[model samples]
Target: MSVLDTRCVNQLYLTLSNILSISESDLRQYVIDKKFELLDIAWSEIDIDEFFKTVKSNVNRLKGNIIESVTISHLSSRLEYECNKENIYNLYSALTGETKLRKYLSDVGIECIHESDVISVFFHGERIDWKQYEQTPVVLMLQKRLGVTSSGDKCINGFLFSGDIHKNMNVTHIARIPEFLENLLRILKVHEAIYFWERNAQPYEIIFKEKFSGIIYDGDDSLSLEDKNIKTIKHCISFLGRNLFNEWNQNDNPIIRLKDDNDVLADQIISSRNLKTNRIIFK
Candidate 1:
């Protein structure tokens, strides 16, 4: 193998076991000159799974103490153990990998992951020190995967009670509430909310403030916090469909929906939508 090529692959985190044997100075120069070109090449060659494996290997092997380890399953371990069998499976499937366990995503179809899910893999693994890993473009992308990094600042773990449920809420239970109204409210902390009847939404459609982004998931089979949230949201939507249709069949009057105003995201979304008596509304 070319010394040039092996060094590039090494920088990409493909294999860390001395794929190249150049000296420290030569190694640094090799990376400085050629790493970016290799990164662009590798990005197209590798699937996300292999890329994740490379990340884990490098993190475990890194020589310093700057990696801040975080994973929803690990962070919210107790929450999963305390839940139901299906719930536990849902949680397990989310953290481990969802493409293996579930065949169909209920009403929308299995292909709906891109449409239904949001912010998948929030806070992937840990808050890695950019200074330590920035030598490699792959690691740079890993940091980006964890979140958007500004200049100079070291990345750190973030926590909050609400706002961007994609980044905050660690449980799937809230997502299972109909129209995702309840979970929506908890994230945004608004007093009112609305749910648009799209299969899965592009965040641009919900535009309001700094709280906006569009289509944040990559539709991987791997389990993630976003998977739990999406699955729960779908179940909740199905429940609403059944309950509302059934009640309408019996009484033939307009259905009055009940909701908790305390959920911030839900309130903002609902308040944004203007609903007439018989039709679904989209804002």
Candidate 2:
């Protein structure tokens, strides 16, 4: 079985505890001590700093406390154990954090299944080739650094990244980018490129720097506000609630492209894999 590091365990514990309102001490008592046994590791094998830092970062990020109450209830219904908070916490944390827990739970007649990974992120309308860049610094920045700020159904394997070839611009908005990046990716489920134009940036260009790139449009008077594209942009604003719209629109950044002129943009979205044809089909 693959061993989870202390950092991963802490992330799992803190995330589940925050969502379910179960304290860490309770988690240790009811789950770690009684339900499943964890393998001991040497001190030198663990990054002690990362272990504590992850715990601290999880605490800070959860300060917002935005995980909806209804979500917890819905998750409780799907659990295999008693619906009480402690059992629910153990069930969910085990499913996510420990492979050993799966075997133990299965022995007790709980159905434990693993879901296939979903490529939930897209760059410049393409699926990210994560394997090729596993050792690259971009992976560290985008995955490790950005992950500290990510929320909602957090999983290590859910995101994807792809984009244009311009890898030289300074990504000044990395912090703000994560706030709306996941929502923008979900919007791409039914649409293509979500273009945001800044008054200072060039028109119809995908700017790439700091290992990321995205299509941008300049909301200039020369480009009439009455244009259909502009109307579509507004439609997107109205469609995606005010909070998400404001997140993307802050600091003069306005969405300029969602679907292309001929609706060819969705073709770039990876919706289905046609194995017989050896091609990816879009939404």
Candidate 3:
């Protein structure tokens, strides 16, 4: 007979206990009964010690295959309860010591700022803050991009929704928002590029001012200047797609001041590429 890993069994038992809101003592019996029912066998048909050993062995097997573990499935099933699969997956990750959001960010040289109401990141000497909005177009775009629950308030429970893990599992407390972190990294790269252009291009101010002043200066006269402006605009548009830039020309947009004045020029520029530009920015 193989030795049982009591640690793994205890961890799994604790996890199931917390998730099901049942005491560990009662949970053990419930699991045994559930397993007996699943196997279509009476408790008297199997020796109790042997059955428990089998249960511990099954828990050991769940170390690397938690999501698909039959024991987890059995424990999670309830007549009136619907399981949250994502939460279970996160719990499994926590148990297995998987890399989570904060650690992942630190590994890639991005620092997470712990704030009360917003998700903030410090990258390339810039601190960017993302505020949560229920189901606005920007929030919808982010949720869709991140594969969070769309079409309802369920999205608010996703990691991307609050830039952290679901609030339920306070035991492990690991923050696992991989998709949001990756998206933020991409946006930060583009943001850094735009900032580089802003610092290096002497014509940036002229182009920006002229672009919004109703004075059309197509970069056809200065190819280099035109290229830089177009790249800057593209980056801004990309930010808009990520909701890092405000789509409604709101004054609170972190990036740039976009108003009615630049609407036509911005539209023409974006339209040339068959792309749509919302009132997003370059601050």
Candidate 4:
């Protein structure tokens, strides 16, 4: 009745068709074209007997071997077939716009789908390209996160794997994606190594570096002769370093760099409170 219910019913149809060796697209079209015949059957009032009788005829006529013999005396016996009667009913509901099959599945608390089981019966571990779904939002999200542009990337069907980089930004926004990824992986690896190396390592949190800046010092040559000018120069240099550190940490993007002997940012100075850790870490 609702949009979500409609979508679930559609997915239920597709998954069932893949299970039963039927064409979901053809079945959907058949139901749409022959709505008059299906509407008179009172699909909402379907019992086990009514469902079996209605589906047995269609299955026998459409594909012949799909149901074999539907002279089912018991629901338990119906499960003995290569394709169970309940799944056949799910396919039927998908074809005829009925909700009873989905309702029956929900009532029995058996809604989870085991992908391994489906693949064993239908695909046997062969890769299915499903090229039609390339335009879907789910695929696009994976592309953005994993830096997948085409199908041939090292990603496992667009899934992010180790050594993958988040290259969604342009070269202007993020220069050298490969180098960025290399440094990112190195930083994460170092964090992981340190975590395992320590006996009391807690879970590490991520820290992102957004921007970088530096303060410029300008003074008259006449003023350089005084101790006050020299002190001011030292203080200004310290202030510039502090400003640059703050600017980098103000962003949500992860900063990639090698650590020094103290596991610090090498040349940068930042407070522990900003990263919430004595050492910088990444996920």
Compose the digit string of candidate 4's lDDT tens values, residues 1-283.
0000001235434533343345766535444543443443332222323322433323322331232110010010111112111222222222123344233233333232223212101122333233434455555433333233433111101000111122223112221212222232232233442222222322211121111111111222232223322322222222222233342111212222211111112122111111112232211
TM-scores for all candidates: the values are 0.17, 0.16, 0.21, 0.17
Task: Indicate the worst ten consecutive residues by lDDT in candidate 1.
Answer: 67-76
Backbone collision tally, model 3: 1
Q: What local lDDT does model 1 show for residue 156? A: 14
What is the RMSD of candidate 3? 27.5
Going through the candidates in the order shown, the clash numbers are 25, 3, 1, 0
TM-score of 3: 0.21
Model 1 residue 121 CA deviation (Å) reads 23
lDDT of 1 by residue, 195-262 (tens): 32223222111111111111112232243434422332222222223333332121111111111111
Model 4 residue 172 lDDT score? 22
Per lDDT, the best of the predicted structures is 3
Please give the lDDT score at residue 10 for candidate 4. 55
- What is each predicted model's overall lDDT from 0 to 1? 0.24, 0.27, 0.29, 0.25
Model 1 off-target regions past 4 Å? 1-26, 35-42, 45-283
Identify the superior model by TM-score, candidate 1 or candidate 2: 1
Candidate 1 is scored at a TM of 0.17
- Residue-by-residue lDDT tens digits, candidate 2, 217-252: 323224332242222222222212222222222222
Off by over 4 Å in 3: 1-100, 129-177, 190-283
What is the Cα-based lDDT of residue 99 in candidate 3? Answer: 32
Winner by lDDT between candidate 2 and candidate 1: 2
For 1-283, candidate 3 gives per-residue lDDT tens digits of 1111111246445644343334667646644554434244322233434433533433332222222111100011111121112222222122123334345455556664423322345664566434443455555454443334432111111110111111224311112212333245555554453333234322101011122212222222232433333322222222223332223221211122222122212212110100011112121
